[model samples]
Target: MKNTILILFITLLSVSCKKEPQYLVKIEGKQLPISAEIASDKTIEDFILPYKEKVEAEMNTVLSYTPKDLVRIDGKLESSLGNLMADLCFERANPVFNSRTGKNIDFAMLNFGGIRAGITKGDIKTINAFNLMPFENSLVVVEMTAEKVTELAKYLIAQNKAHPISKQLNLIVEANEYNLTIHNLPLDDSKTYFVLTSDYLQNGGDNMVFFKDPVKLFKLDYKVRNSIIDYFTEIDTIKVELDGRFTKEN
Candidate 1:
């Protein structure tokens, strides 16, 4: 009996000592290595490349299908705003998903830098999507307010060309100053707005701290890129016609 118990105990110990598998992310360039993962194993050869290939494949699937991108707003301001929204979305699939699991989400936001590619009159592809936003960014949603929207607009104008905004925004470059209409809109303090954004901004990485204001802050379970991908896919048909409704410029 004693011998059997000892054997069982040894087996349990060995099992516990075994390492589980995981995906690993390695960052070089800095002195200290930045290592992380969404998987279990940490070895570069064992995990990172394959996982990356899988993600890339997934991204390519939808990206390859998009024919062309379009922006149709009533005025230059609205048009610019629409362009910005679309550009930011092109950065990723912008999926709205479950919050607890860091899944794709509904209604997301993208920054202008992500819109790296200009849609020409032709078929769009994964390469095009990659060209638009090459970074390994995820999607996120925030709870904001109309007041916060005003702040965002003011921040954009105040920063002028320096502001990292979506293509949806328009600034009058010649005047050396940009005007904002957000201030003109009345902001109710208690009203909350669901603002979907890229994961980069939520973690204080984007310097858009106003998004984190205590009163206006509500975190949502969503990834902007993934959700955006879902949206595009759901649309089924590709339609590109010039509405000529740029809202921001006018």
Candidate 2:
């Protein structure tokens, strides 16, 4: 009996000291479909219903109207959508920048790819602004010398894409040479120009390295999306046209 008890105790101790087996599960099976019959939790649905309803209401609120469709397309010097967005950026941020720095924003530039969606010929809603500028990029003023501005123009010419540029600047691209005018005047290499752009571009987004080394940077603390929304709210109708702000010649 003593031997039996000792043996049992030793066995139990050895079993307890044994290491647990490791598992290397190789799941090799096709994905199974989730059936629609699965019932949702009523508690979760109740909790989310109010927030969903509020969001839908706000998103569906009409802000403005567009008579024509504005779209961003490739291989074009300019687009209606690009013109509208850049103009709005300038219109909205210029006053704030002037108020803070007492300097006028010479022009505004936005990446073509940044304007995510097109505006249809119908009512523009708050959700449209959200969809157009989905990123949280803030407007910032970059103080650049005329030389830097020249570099920017050259960059635009080389890119040959539909980059959004305000009316204050014009570019004519020829075979090997490019002509750039700011405010209907030739670029003065001695002057410094304040330019409004998103923080993303100022930080070298979209290969806009010229915006990197600025003489000064002013953070407007204004989101680009909010600017669009505000502009839409202030205007009853939105109008934009392609007036050869950017042109190409052989």
Candidate 3:
């Protein structure tokens, strides 16, 4: 009887000491305004100065020169800046895609709004590439069917914006109909075509739904801004032209 009482007391004591689960009941937030009133940390600032100077020097390094301004708003159906962006991306990304897949990208496309800045007639610096493409969008190749290609053409026609397309494609809009040729050849419905685009567009960004759910997807692991920088580094002078790659009948 004594031992039973002792065992019962120990059980009760153990139960009483058990911890209950705690939960977050409420969350309060306070805004700390960053203003001149707040003191700067001199140690941190001093440590970062060298890195900042190095980065600025690299960004200002001259890559190439442009004789004329490359602006996105310069053309109605196609812009000089857009032409250069698309052409350089195609040129840089094609070899990478070809080496992996043994096939070439039919063309490259980018949104008109993607060109964030313009290049003035002067020495081009590394910062120009970053200013032109401010996003971290990477290159991707989507193998699309003829039906999707038609949808792409229709989307461009309806928008009537100067969305960038590589020189490999010629898109002409007449009335409600459009004509498209890839690499100087008519688009063949019997075969699938590979198109180079940013990963963002391939995921249906900027209302470009035709690039989503492609027949096949190939990621080149290359960023668009990097491609622009590389192309600029290779060439001493940059040239751009609309060249009738895309046109609309009046």
The number of the candidate with the highest TM-score is: 3
lDDT of candidate 3 over 48-159, digit per residue (tens): 9999999999999999999999999999989999999999999999999999989998999999989999999999999999999989999999999999998998888889
Span of ten consecutive residues with least summed lDDT in model 1: 241-250
What TM-score, over all chains together, does every model reach? 0.47, 0.86, 0.89
Please give the range of 10 consecutive residues that has the lowest summed lDDT in model 3: 171-180
For candidate 1, write residues 29-135 as lDDT tens digits: 75755567445555766767888888777656643233544432223233343443444453343322233535432233444444444544445444544555566
Prediction RMSDs, each to the true structure: 12.9, 3.7, 2.6
Off by over 4 Å in 1: 1-109, 145-147, 160-186, 214-222, 237-250
The Cα error of candidate 2 at residue 233, in Å, is: 0.4
Best by lDDT: 3
Candidate 3 ranges beyond 4 A from true positions:
1-20
* Ranked candidates, highest TM-score first: 3, 2, 1
- Cα lDDT, all candidates: 0.48, 0.92, 0.94
Model 2 segments more than 4 A misplaced: 1-35
Candidate 1 local lDDT, residue 140: 50
